[model samples]
Target: MTILQPFSKLLKTIEPLWKIHFEPRVPAEELAKSRTAGSIPSFGFFFLLTLASIIATLGLITNSSAVIIGAMIVAPLMNPILSLSFATATGNWALFLRSGLTIVLGSFLAMGVAFLVTVLSPWDVVGSELLSRTRPTMLDLGIAIAAGAAGAFSLTRMSIASSIAGVAIAVALVPPLCVVGIGLAGGSAMTGVFGNFYVTNLDVAGGASLLFLANLIGITISACLVFVLQSYGSLRKALKSLALGLLVALMLSRPLGTSLHEFAVDNRVQLELHGLHRDGRFRDVNLIHRVDTKLVNGVAYVNIFGAANEEFIEDQKNIDNLDQRIFNAIQPMGVHTMHIAIRIAPIEIFEYRNTSSSYSYQP
Candidate 1:
């Protein structure tokens, strides 16, 4: 009894501040009702989801970020996801089941729609925007978590409700799933060759599906935390759900961490290669057309395509020296073994003197 007195007094002191600041502006019951209604599968919901999926698929095919953003704004997928998070927080078994089913149904519907669109379209192009979603890193998890928190917080305050669109765009719930369908429909077995190294054909659908799963798990966990913090649900009740989410997130982090490492290494290699181009040794190089870096079995393989003066292009010794310099530049970055391939196109200049005032042509 004596030990409990201090804790009781501390709670009394903190209760007012908690209610004033941390408590949600909207009533918990009201918010739950709203989310429950939104989670129901209706014509409107499927219609918007279908349109959003088609738009997203087309945007990905065309490599238009702006169009993709528009699809994100129009997507109705976020609501069901938020509903699921709310269900987890409040321990509403009925809402939980409903939201889960809705999410699954909506996901497949969007994928089907995207697949159909991709199949019917005349253009069979896979753009960078689409491929970018295939390799998700821990960085994507962080974004999903942050977006989930922001989305939950905004829902509790009506004034900031409009920001949910931005949250949708940030997390990108539909685009990745659409990419899955697009990958299944039009994706081909493609190989990336860098110098002597090459990557096997990638499973585009599998990678994009993993990205969607990551986003789903990340958003659910973070939103549940936000809901509990805002007093919309009890932490004790949400513990089991949160625990399961954490378990999945932990499993996901392993692959995501590996991907993050690869991305960092690739970026480092690209920067080093770019630095080589700016150095005095490559002064004759006019412009770098492209630089591609790939890591295979702990070895870095770099491919460089650039335009250089005729003199530099013809000099075998200078080219060999440049290759050696590239190896030296990237060696310190923990890359013990590397292969480099350089393709330089000569930049030829032709000058014609117009000595005659009037032009005359004889055929």
Candidate 2:
């Protein structure tokens, strides 16, 4: 009934049209052969991934990009995330659950192992990599959704996996969890990132974890659609599978669902901002950029960047009362407390003298 259903139907027609030529969705058996190869996690690889996750956590806590990247390479998590999509496509519930549990349990394993190392180790600082995970917003959701699609598509085509692996890292599951444990270990203010504030470790951890889930969910959606198209199953079966999978995906994305609601509201806020900007009461200014939405205590804390500072300020003395100006801009939104990352340059002061009819000037 919806536009999307019809569009999906139209795409399905292409499969029937081309079904004569394409190879049957590679038999599920061939794929499983590789499973046994990785069955007994060699002590070396196990310790390597475990050790790497720990070092990466340490790197994140120290805000070290280089260190964190090293951890990503050593991370064996990507295989499971991809395997999750693979198993979902084939309707192999065993593999699906196996991969899913591998990811979930592996994540816990990585975090626990990393925490033990951090707890015992000497360094005791929480860095930016740790700080970055403390918020979940539209942006983080978007990244995961996009990456999920990419991962599924790449799997379908079997092309360029290293790049896809990098993207898996970018969704960045391991690092943020490491950061969360570090925050707990340090007993830092968890408000913004995780507990209640904008950039708390919880915020970042929840957001990043949600992002990972979104990627997995997104990949599954794409995989399901592809399976349906490829005669992965009959229409009735596909629909049932899709419905069931979507239901589960939705549950995994509770934080993402809230963000979507906030984002819809944020969109309306943008529509109103145009009128605010056009009125020129904002001082003939133009916007530079703005973070249209953010999360704080599970609500939106949106910001818009505009070019004019004077629109919000009248004189040098006004700088002293900047809080009032910020309050006035945000008061209408019922924002209890908001932070403005505004940029301004002080106006140069000069006294002028008019000397003649032609008005020769001096300062």
Candidate 3:
């Protein structure tokens, strides 16, 4: 028996409940026709896509989440993607080709529009919104899968079709592609936040493109599965496409896994820093200006910039003890070797008494 035999049997056991609870309100044939029609690249589709791309690009540049969400609502790209998934599931070659072409053209159109906008605009800085899409992890793949399933399910039930907007926001098809355009347009280099884990010269275009590809592949595979499960298509017919999609997702998992590891390490470093502060080791430090951690050649380097009181600055032994504590704290997290540097500047505090009209240095 195949490895899926047990799961298949379990699904069979619940077949009645599945059908009763999840039957599509729309007929499969009608739904397929609707999706196929929507996939056609009409003038209206391109016009709306262009507007969404412009809005999304501006949002990324300005770091406005609300504007990006507005673009997501306006974007028509999701229809073609869903059509592609349905076509793949049903083994409809003509619909597949049409939807695939629409997707490709729409992608390039959005990218081109974004490129032109970024080139013309004076704002060239890569902001938090743009940087967030650059390094996608497996969690992003999970979100795409869930969103794809939700999107397909909502389409089958007209009452809940409005949820498609939320699904579009969740998967984010256009913004990352717009980021790809901005990156290609030679936006300023991104550093400081995401720079510690990656090299100074990170490939902004490549990373955002990978994110878009991940979302695309993830949605296609998952939406196809949902269609098959809803009895809209035959599993045997969809198997080949599903296998190919899985293979691509597998290939993508490598880099995504590495990014996830880096994210985890960064979180751990922050947690350790907070732990030190709570444990009183950082009591003398007034504020932590920045913390940067880099892993290179099997060694980890940590740099901390902070402002501290004069007592911490004057006492060499205290600084040495704190350094040893930080090193010890991070060593247990699987680092081969570690180098730490803490730069601190002295800070002074002042207090004034209104009644006495006098000011005193509180140190």
Off by over 4 Å in 2: 1-29, 32-45, 188-212, 223-245, 248-254, 257-321, 328-363
Q: For each candidate, what is the lDDT?
A: 0.83, 0.57, 0.84
**What 10-residue stretch in candidate 3 is worst by lDDT?**
191-200
Superposition-based RMSD of candidate 3 using all C-alpha atoms, in angstroms: 6.4
TM-score between candidate 2 and the true structure: 0.60
Model 2 lDDT per residue over 134-185, tens place: 5455566567666666654454443353566666566676676676555555
TM-score of 3: 0.81
Candidate 1 residues 85-151, lDDT tens each?
9999999978889999999999999899988987888865556687789888899999999999999
Candidate 3 lDDT by residue in tens digits, 268-338? 76676677778887777767765656666447777777777888799998778776766666667666787
Backbone collisions counted per model = 0, 20, 0
Instruction: Select the stronger candidate by lDDT from 1 and 3.
Output: 3
Against the true structure, whose TM-score is highest? 3
**Clashing residue pairs, candidate 3?**
none
Candidate ranking (lDDT, best to worst): 3, 1, 2
Best by lDDT: 3
